[model samples]
Target: MDPVVLAAGSALVSAMATDGWQQTRAAVVEWWRRRRPDRADGVGSDLEAVRAQVLAAREQGDEDTEQALAGAWRLRLQQLINEDPALADELRRLLDEHVDPALSDGEQPQHRPIIMKAEARDNSRVYQAGRDQHITGS
Candidate 1:
């Protein structure tokens, strides 16, 4: 998948979970209106339906369902980009201008880097993770 499509899909799902979702949803539908006027209404309705599902999934702590919803939107976006290619720019703009801002308004996760150093006389072991990691030692 295109990086922009991936980012936009994730942002779209994240925005749907925010209080600013209505505005973000409107922008998305309007973008679809310009690109595929005939399908705009259906697209809007589908977005709303998906948003409802996402909300319910979050309430139930169903990460799998939320991720599945994101994947669906990613596929939809991938199809759009495959058809027009130029829509990739529009998706990036939507993510940068609207979706990302809405997500920022909500609680943003904090990430911190990890640094580790280890030394031993007989042996040495070191484990480091800048992000998520798993390690086993013997």
Candidate 2:
């Protein structure tokens, strides 16, 4: 499978689980709008249906179902790209510009970030913790 198709498919399903999914949905439909204009409307409707399934799966704690949905989309995108290899670039652009941002917004949680960096030389040890660290028998 094309990496771009994999990424776009993953992003498409991930975005469907987010509040900003409508934006990604629009971007996807628009992709069809440009190349397969006749299918654009149906694509949008299909995405909506997928979104509903995703939400329900999430609510039911059905990770497998969600993953299955992602897989289905991956195949769909691969088919699209198969028909027009040129679409790979466009799909990459859409994932970067539209889908990723929507994922970030939708997955935001009420938690602070934890950053840790370590550089060890000459058998030196570096330890960092965001919350707590306990070392014994050093």
Candidate 3:
């Protein structure tokens, strides 16, 4: 999947759970309106339905369901971009301007790289990881 689509889809799903979802939703539907005016209304309705489902899944503590919803939206966005290659830039702008800012308002996410290394000698072995790890020796 395109990285912009992936990021936008994730940001869309995250925005749906935030108070600024309406703004993000409007921006999405407006973009659709410009591209395919006939489908814009339906797309808006569908977005609402998806948002409801995402919220319900989150309430039920169903991470898998939420992820599946995100994947669905990602695919939809990918299709749109496939049809009109120019929309890719618009999606990126939406992410940077609307969706991402909404997500960052409360608490910024933390990202850290993880590195792992292993070495073995004739009669000994070593295993290491910055986080989780599993190892077997003989």
Candidate 1 deviant stretches above 4 angstroms: 105-138
Which residue pairs show backbone clashes in model 1?
none
Model 3, global lDDT: 0.82
Indicate which candidate wins on TM-score.
Answer: 1
Question: How would the candidate models be sorted by lDDT, starting from the highest?
Answer: 1, 2, 3
Task: Assess each prediction's global lDDT (C-alpha) against the native.
Answer: 0.83, 0.82, 0.82
Misplaced by over 4 Å in model 3 are 105-138
lDDT agreement of model 1 with the native: 0.83
Query: Tens digits of per-residue lDDT for model 2 on 70-116?
Result: 89999988999999999888887777788888877545222333677
What is the C-alpha lDDT profile of model 3 across 1-138, one tens digit per residue? 878888777778878888888998998898889989999999999999989998999899998988898899999999999998989888887777777877765432222235667779898967676667777665
CA RMSD (A), model 3 = 6.2
For residue 52, what is the lDDT in candidate 1?
96
Residue 33 of model 1: what lDDT? 97
Model 2 CA RMSD to the hidden true structure, in angstroms: 5.8
